[model samples]
Target: MTTSSDQQHREAALTDTVLRSFESCTDPRLKLVLQSLVQHLHDFIRDVRLTEDEWRTAIDFLTEAGHITDDKRQEFILLSDVLGASMQTIAVNNEAFKDATESTVWGPFFVDGSPEIPLGGDMTLGAAGEPCWVEGSITDTDGNPVPDALVEVWEADENGRYDVQYRDGRTAARAHLRTGDDGGYRFWAVTPTPYPIPHDGPVGALLAAVGRSPMRAAHLHFLVRAAGYRELVTHIFVEGDELLADDAVFGVKASLVKQFERARGATPDGRELDGRSWSRVRFDIVLAPHGS
Candidate 1:
């Protein structure tokens, strides 16, 4: 008869056998990574006393997540965001940029090839949201302007839905612009609104299972790139947003939040805005050196 000691011995043997299988790996880093992964996975299974049915359910959940992922949607990334893995990865890799703009999770909705817009052009494209003007300068950590930097921006409409969500093959509320010689750029966009991540997939179901809400705070995404600096992927969260303290993806940083103030009659650069009241935000971004 198999006793408790027998089961323990069998488990130990299985872990050793699996680890030994990686002995023939030629790459030292690969071998180390695989061995460490195996050890931690085995320990977690033991600590949780994971049942066979639970293992099966997890496998099924992951399979479903993969199945739902496509060109326009990334369910696995969504899962990573909900589980805080994305933020953790960002934290580990972005330690040197403390003086520069802090990095945050690049949500699953970023699309390439947004139309290039000129300075002071409108990015809202008639999408429904309060009109807002965003002007920012790109500078090095030493406060020197980094001229001719490319700034890519994208955000959801007032209803918190991206252009991709409609599957309509059109881009809205997204654009790219180059900084002028002064490292300054400006464009008009809609004020951001709180929205839930795609919640119709396995990640959504997992959030429901854990009694968690999937709402992200109001924020605008920016990707700044220059010839000789580290590329930055980050967000400017609206100050005093109710959900800022509880972003579903934990992407909010106190330094990244800015006050989007209400304005009347004129823009920041002294141009007459069309009689309608608007919101204005000024964000100066600093980039860390490439090797920093």
Candidate 2:
């Protein structure tokens, strides 16, 4: 009979062998990463005494995730998000720096080449949701305006569905715009609403099995970029969202929460709402210098 000590010795020997196999890797970083991965992976396997059935189930789960992924949907990213790995990775890369805006998970729904809109223009493009005015300023750590910054925004509609979720290939509730000379930006958009992340696939099944909800808090997404500053990928969560404390992807930060005040009749830009109610919110962003 193999004693527990013998079993541990055998596992360590196997891990060392795998580590040595990467000794010839040409890149120092690659070598370091592979060795550490081997060490941790082996340790986890040993700690769990993972059964063959469990290992096969994991492999099958990953296979299904890859099968569901495509240009319009990214199951792997969804998997990462649900596991809290996405937030953990973001936290590791975005260190604290003098009041710079916090970063969060970049959801799988983002698409490139979003339509561009002028300041104060409407980004809704006919999506179904309550109208909202989003205004904010882009500034550096020293409080100076960062003019001409590109701000990309996207969000789900009242029904909690993104444009990409529909079959017709229509774009709505998303656009990109540049900041004004004074670093101010304003645009019309749909007010954010609470929604569940796509939960019909492997990630959803995992959440269900673990008794966790796949719901995210109401929020607006932003990807702000400017020369000489670190890119800001974040969200402004609705202040009173009940899910704020339990965001599926763990993306909410206290500083990013903001109130969405109700509006009626007239808009700041003098547009007529024709008696329809609306909301307005402000989100001033501060960017850290590239090296900071």
Candidate 3:
């Protein structure tokens, strides 16, 4: 089936009219962004010939997503994680700098303003679980040290629940600390364990409809910031963890994986870890230089 010349001209006219309307804009950056979005969105609609029902369903999904968000969670980030677009965008924007660390998605659960903690301290705040240690450094892309870089971190508790998920029970796992003079930093926290994405929301419903799992493998989340360097949001996964390849949010990167080694010595305080045992881990982060 071939379209009549008039029909083709009408579609072309619509495309031109929409695109040209933005040409008079003085802001070059805004103009370029609007142009690209228009081009891709138009192409998508034409290529898929999306049905009215499909469009309506999309609107409903977005509406519900907004409705479900609170101070502690972001539904849109969850949506993007499932689609892999968040990680892709991060990768594209965070192309290697001389020695800077790459940025990944600041996943939905990040709650700003965590408590400040001392070096070698536990962000777990006396929570129950396997003892885990996370240590790392912040360096420029050139491998130069970035001293005093602020490393902010947050993660779920032992019961696979975030602070927000609990009702005034205990403190959230949020913590903030700066890198030492050698650009190295270490902290004690429970080894991360796999947890399910909130499955009672609209996104969960979508996942269920598609026969997908909501499980995110155990991993530590980081938000590293430095003077004259780009801020980074990423995760360090435990080696041999079962969900590495299938993170519910698809946030894992091959380069970000680290081994959580077992250590037999006494903990930092020179005391036995309840006479059970203690595990040690080291995760170093490298950052990109300024103005890259």
| Winning candidate number (TM-score) | 2
Model 2: C-alpha RMSD to truth? Answer: 1.3
Off by over 4 Å in 2: 1-3
Give the candidates in order of lDDT, highest first: 2, 1, 3
190: Cα error in model 2, Å: 0.8
Cα-based lDDT for every prediction: 0.91, 0.94, 0.81
Cα lDDT of model 3 by residue, 90-196, tens digit: 88878787545556778777776788888887788866677777777777766777888888888887788877777675676768898889998888888788899
Model 1, span 1-292: residue lDDT tens: 2349878888889999999999999999999999999999998987788899999999999999999999999999999998899999988887766589999999999888888999998887767788899998999989999999999999999898999888667789999999999999999998899999999999999889899899999999999999889889999999999999889999999999999998888776676656877898999999998867
Model 2 agreement with the true structure over 42-143: per-residue lDDT tens digits: 889887888999999999999999999999999999999988999999999999899999999999999999999999999999999999999989999899
Best by lDDT: 2
TM-score for each candidate, following the candidate numbering: 0.94, 0.98, 0.91
- What TM-score does prediction 1 earn? 0.94
Whole-model lDDT, model 2? 0.94
Write down the worst ten-residue block by lDDT for model 3.
Answer: 268-277
Clashes of 1: 0
Which residue pairs of candidate 2 clash? Answer: none
Ranking by TM-score: 2, 1, 3
Instruction: Please estimate how well model 3 matches the true structure, expressed as its whole-model Cα lDDT.
Output: 0.81
